[model samples]
Target: MEVDGSKGNMAESPTNSQQTVSDDDEIDYSVKPEFYDPKLDDKDELWVQKRRKGYTSDAVLSCPACFTTLCLECQRHEKYVTQYRAIFVINCKIDSDQVLKQNGPKLIKGKSRREASSVGGETLKKVSCSACSTEVGVVDEDEVYHFFNALPSES
Candidate 1:
């Protein structure tokens, strides 16, 4: 019950000699825990990906006339869209069956003015709105797409 004033009123920390290290509890000094961004790493696979691959809200591309959902455009399909002549060519698998359904004489493919530029040398047809018979875009002979919907510029 006696209070000893021998030690000073200060906190004492253990010296290096007093510190302990174990083989199993090894510390990695080379690598540190950090927030990793794939775009910043040269060796990362995404590093080779588009530097200007713009981030856009997930969009549903539709027929400009009837507003029928033609395709779902996102960052994944954005990479496949390329420039062909004066129009942008969509060379990815979109929802073609529902968008380009045949009813009576209504086929998605109308005669296109675009040259014979296709994936397999097949003739490309202008994509028409199945509901409104409006020329929306173009498609290939394989029933796959090379869609040419020009997004209206915002003013």
Candidate 2:
């Protein structure tokens, strides 16, 4: 019931200030990656081609082939399309240091192992009208793409 102000008791150690020194030496407790593999702080740079203002529209029109108003243009509500041959530019930077540099086949890896037989080495194939089999165009690593516009040009 009485307060023990003695040296070894609660108020006992007059050298209590020295106890803090021992506590400072306690193991530095901190969370760290278990498998501390040091990684380069560099980040892969990426650039996105911005769509031109005039190229994109919110109008729709009927399709010439199907005469269906439900085509891609008509669905978008864009009636008067700015007909232009689109050169789809794809920049494939193939640095010698990069394992899959400018190599489309190497990058795609020919589909999953389960789909090995179903797919071939990734190659740029000419896109043609599935219905008409018309040669649309091809894509490659040079960042150059040429295709005919199904839509009309801006008059």
Which candidate has the top score in lDDT? 1
Clashes of each: 1, 12
**Candidate 1, residues 1-155: lDDT per residue as tens digits?**
23346864556667776787775579575785487565566553243234214433234355566566454432224454531222222322223333333334344432332422331244545565566666655455465554456343211
Candidate 1 regions with alpha-carbon error over 4 angstroms: 1-58, 73-120, 150-155
TM-score of each: 0.30, 0.21
Per-residue lDDT, model 1, residue 57, is: 24
What does the lDDT read for residue 106 in candidate 2?
Answer: 40
Question: Relative to the true structure, how large is the alpha-carbon lDDT of every model?
Answer: 0.43, 0.33
Residue-pair clash count for candidate 1:
1
> Per-residue lDDT for 33 in model 2?
55
